[model samples]
Target: MTLRRRATGLALAIATGTTLALTGCDAAKDAASDVIASATAAVASAAQEKMNEIKDGVDAAADVKAGRTSVDGDRTVAEITATNPKDKTADYTVMVNFRDGDGNLLDAVVLNIDGVEPGTSKSGTARSNRTLTGDTTAEIAQALRH
Candidate 1:
């Protein structure tokens, strides 16, 4: 074979191999991205499920109240007060929901205040389970007295 022909053939082969190798790298990158996206979706779904569990609770809105929400570092916090009107001391399971300005649920936290005396109010702090950003407010979602 002629030297010029052999050199051209060798160059063509190298170009083809490089192109295939780059295509394989792109495919690998795409697969990795898909896995990361799926993992992220799973984590988000689990978080929502946990919040829904808190939603399945008793409603005693008349006896409990939530204060304005504040941000302490990356965490959202709020004050909760539970009034015991019963004849005996009772425990309170309070669910505080943090929301955005448009009333979207950002996070929910349960605060347990036990042994509240009759005709008195017990105060406790409720904090977000994860870091929250942007403007947020807090409201009472559910409260159970026992």
Candidate 2:
């Protein structure tokens, strides 16, 4: 072939190769961007789920603290009779007994009273301030009423 024709053909081939290389580089960049976008979306979804779980846990704890259980029970009132006095404080033991309708002993609860005076007949009333899991509190209240 003539030298000028051969040189022209070579230049055309080189230009085509450069164009293909540039297109391949653009495709790679686009693929990488797509992958990054998908990864970012997945991470955001996981974070939202974790936040929802944390909110649910906080709500459950608040319900328990408010004493909003479904347990059936009644309040029992008891009197504090004696106590042991200490420096600016005292402790007293109060007994609470529970029984069924047929007079069968079910349970007993002993609670310590703090800041009570020794040798004093302190006539204070006690009651279950929160809901219980069983009828023990109800039975104790019935026995005290009698």
Candidate 3:
């Protein structure tokens, strides 16, 4: 091949490699939508775990739930539902967050539940430290069935 042709090919390969490397770094962090989706799934899984705990085994499980967020004066309140799916009582830790229209987190709080009876659903609320305005969103950050 000509010397000029070889030089051009090497430059193109280097440029392609550089672009791929940069793109990988740019997408290093999770996107807002991806975070939201994962959080939603986790919250739903917690709820289902509680609901199905009452069943004889883990193989028997059903149900899904969503969290709620509302503005109450100077405090933003977030509520997430958890269930005791087992035949016995249980406890769970739930984390809730308040966000604005742009998906910016305004506040977050952790909630706890004790003595949740079998086959029952209980709601836990987290109040933000500061007030929120404009469009607000509430999501469950984490829920652990204990």
Candidate 4:
């Protein structure tokens, strides 16, 4: 038996006032046993809704790791991790868009990661075009293979 844990805070989940922790086999079984009946239904429904909204009828070929945005001195930086699941090497261009509390686009930037090998993951960062105020949300505008 092996156990691995990587914990990171996600802005979207935090914004939604929810926290989801999925652990390895043993811990997963323990978590399953601890959840209340009604809460399970609520979590499933909420997850499905969020998936549909994010996918927008498009299939997700790749996965974006839990991302976080933070104020970096004079600029806001968005960091994202991506996993590529193919044999050949590929380049990914990820657009990280910054939005205001009202869902208005504030500033955006593209994070380019080159030469991602098969079945491997990498981290990339993008800086906001301009300073943003108030509640800022960072989302993956696009994750395309080239």
Candidate 5:
């Protein structure tokens, strides 16, 4: 083969190899993105199911309140207070919700405070189910006394 023709062939081979390599990289990136999206959707679905399982008690939400939320080691936490107004001791189940500054729900947790004396207030801490970022606030979503 002529030397000039050999050089042209080698250049063409390198260009083809480079193009194949770039296409492979793009395909790998797309596959990774799809896996990540699937995992995120699964997590969100599980969290929603957990939130839906909670049922509110009659006229008991007014007895529970959530305090300020703060970050603790990548998790959001808040103080929960439950006031027992019944003549007898009561057990309380409280659902606390964590939200961002834009009012988007980040996490929700159920806390149980048992054997609270009548006319007394009991306090507990509610922690997020997963790591949360940015500004977070907490609110009492539901409360039940039994």
Candidate 6:
């Protein structure tokens, strides 16, 4: 073959290879984006399911209270003295007593704070005088509202 013809053939091959490689890379990126979108949707669905479960549990506890059944805590005793629900704001005086399931008190602490909105629930970590396991105060608050 002539040198010019050979050179032309080599350039065409390189260009074709580069174009194919770029097309493959674009396909891979599109696939990755699809997978990420699917995973994000799954996570959002799971979170919504969990929130619904919490809301249902709270509603069930409310029914139990209405039936005159005591919905007290097994691991903690929470005394909510003040629940002043103003317009879009709620103030509460929460007294928590860490206890066993058998009504035996383990430790006690008081938390008086504001800024909880009424009709809408909020949750956070409890800073007690004694260290306790899990979220006892938050559970108590949920049960009380129910």
TM-score per candidate: 0.61, 0.27, 0.52, 0.55, 0.63, 0.30
Per-residue error (Å), model 5, residue 73 = 2.0
Superior by TM-score: candidate 2 or candidate 5: 5
Count of backbone clashes for each model?
0, 0, 6, 0, 0, 1
Better of 2 and 5 by lDDT: 5
Q: Give the TM-score of candidate 1.
A: 0.61
Candidate 3 regions off by >4 Å? 1-66
The alpha-carbon RMSD values of the candidates against the true structure, listed in the order shown, are 18.7, 32.1, 16.1, 15.6, 17.8, 24.8
Scored by TM-score, the top model is 5
TM-score of 6: 0.30
Best lDDT among the predictions, by candidate number: 5
**What tens digits encode model 2's per-residue C-alpha lDDT throughout 13-128?**
43454455556688755655454334333333432332333321211111111112123245434443433332333433333343335554333333334444544433334343
Please rank every candidate by TM-score, starting with the best.
5, 1, 4, 3, 6, 2
Error of 5 at 59 (Å): 3.5
Q: What is the Cα-based TM-score of model 4? A: 0.55
| lDDT against the true structure, each candidate | 0.67, 0.34, 0.55, 0.55, 0.68, 0.36
Q: Which one wins by TM-score: 3 or 6?
A: 3
Lowest summed lDDT window (length 10), candidate 4: 1-10
Q: In model 5, where do residues sit more than 4 Å from their true spots?
A: 1-57
1-146 in candidate 1: lDDT tens per residue?
A: 33233334434543454455566687755655454334333333443444345543445678898888888786889889999887888877776777878876655566788888999999999887556668889888767776
Query: Cα deviation of 17 in candidate 1 (Å)?
Result: 36
lDDT of 4 by residue, 64-120 (tens): 643667888767787778787777777766656677788865554556677878899
Q: Flag regions of model 4 displaced more than 4 Å.
A: 1-61
